[model samples]
Target: MKKSTFLVFIIVYLFFSISGFLFPFDSDWYRTLAKPDWTPDGSVIGIIWAILFGFIALSTAIVYQERGFGRHNSEYMSLLGINYILNQVFSYLQFNLHALFATFMDALFITITTLLLIFLAGRQNRFAGWLLLPYFLWTAFATYLSWLFYSLN
Candidate 1:
C-alpha cells in the first residue's frame, strides 16, 4: 500500500477511536457489577483495543490497495463499514447506556462481520485477512465476556 493510503486509513481508524473518549468507560459503574475472574483490567483492555485498531487500519489499507473500489468488492466495503459502526457503537452501548444485552449482541455482530471480512479479504489479500485475525479473536472473546456481564449483572 502507498504511504498516503496507509496514512489515511490510520487517520480514519483514529477518528473512530475517538468514540472511546466520547463515551468513556464508567469505571465506577463497572466496578459495582459482578465480573468474571478472568476479566482483564481496564488498562489491559485499552491496550489490547489500541493494538487491534492498528491491525484493523493496516488490514483495511492493504485490502483497499489490493482491491480498489468497484462492484466486485462492494460486499467487502459494506462489511467494513458495518464493522466500523458496530465497533464504535459498543462504547456507547456499554458505557453510556449500560445495556449489557445490547452490547453483547453488538459484540456478536462485530465478530460475525470480522469473520466475513477475513474471508472476503483473504480472497484478495491473504495478509490483510491475517491481520484481522487478532480482531476476530478479540471480538469473540469479548462476546463471551459481554455475555457473562449480562448474565452476572
Candidate 2:
C-alpha cells in the first residue's frame, strides 16, 4: 500500500474519532438500564477508543510494511477498516437510531471482525497482532455492555 493510502485511512479513522466527540455521555435511558457491575464508566469511552484506534493504526501500518503477504494482509486490513466504520455507526444508533436490535447486531459483527483481524495479524505479524489484543478485550467487554443495554432498555 502506498503512503497515501495509509494517510487516507488514518484520516477516515480520525473523522470517526472526531464524530465521537460530539456524542454526549450515554445518559437517560442508559443510566436507567440495569448494566453489569463491571460496565465501564461512560467517561472512559473516549479514552479507550483513542487507545484502541491508535493500536489499530499501528497494526495497519505494520501490515502494509510487511513483504510477500500484501494480498492477504490487504484483505484483513480492509475488513478492519470496514468493521471500524461499522463500530462507529453502531454508536450513532445508541443515540439517534432506535433499532436496538440492529445496534446489537452491529456490535456482534464488530466483535467478529475484530477477532478475525487479530487472528490474521497474529499469524502474519506478531507485533501487529499483539497490538490488537487490547482492542479485542475492549470489544468483548463492550459487546456484553451492548447486549446488556439492549436487554434492559
Candidate 3:
C-alpha cells in the first residue's frame, strides 16, 4: 500500500477510536445487567477493538492500493461507506441510546456488510478478503453477545 493510502487508513482509524470517547461507559447501568458467564471485561473489549481496528486499517489500505478511487471499484467503495456508517450507528445504539436490541440489529448489519466486502475483495485481491476474517469473526461474536444482552435484559 502507498504511504498516502496508509495515512488515510490511519486517519480513519483514529477518527473512530477518538469518537468512542463520546460514549462513556455507564458502570451503574452495566452492573445491573445480566450478562453471560463469559462476558469479557473492559480491558478485553479494548484489546479486541484495537486488534480489530488494526485489521480494518490494513484491509482498507490493501483495497485502496489494489483499486484506487476509480469507477471500477465503486461498489467496493460504496460498501466501505455503508460499513462505516453502520458501525457508527451501532455505537450510537449501544452507548447513547443504550438500546441493546437496536445495537444487536445494527451489529447484524455490520457483519453482513463486512461479509459483502469480503466477497467483493475476493474477486480483486484474495489477501484483502482473507484479511477481514478476524474482523468478521469479532463482529459476529459481538452480534451474538449483544443479542444475549437484549434477551437477558
Clash number by candidate, in order: 0, 0, 0
Q: Is candidate 1 or candidate 2 better by TM-score?
A: 1
Give me the runs in candidate 2 sitting further than 4 Å from their true place. 1-16, 21-29, 67-72
lDDT head-to-head 1 vs 2, winner: 1
User: Which window of 10 residues has the lowest lDDT sum in candidate 3?
Assistant: 15-24
Please estimate how well model 1 matches the true structure, expressed as its whole-model Cα lDDT.
Answer: 0.90
After TM-score superposition, what is the CA distance of residue 19 in candidate 1 from its true location, in Å? 1.6
Question: Per-prediction RMSD in angstroms?
Answer: 1.3, 3.2, 1.5
- Candidate 1 structure quality by residue, lDDT tens digits, 50-147: 98888888887887788775788899889888998999899999999999999999999999999999998899889989999999999999999999
The per-model lDDT (C-alpha) reads 0.90, 0.74, 0.82
Give the true-structure RMSD of model 1: 1.3
35-117: candidate 3 lDDT, tens digit per residue: 99999986788788877777777777777787775899899889988988888787678777899989999999999999998
Q: Which residue pairs come into collision in candidate 1?
A: none
Top-lDDT candidate index: 1
* Runs of candidate 1 exceeding 4 Å displacement: none
lDDT of residue 94 for candidate 1: 95
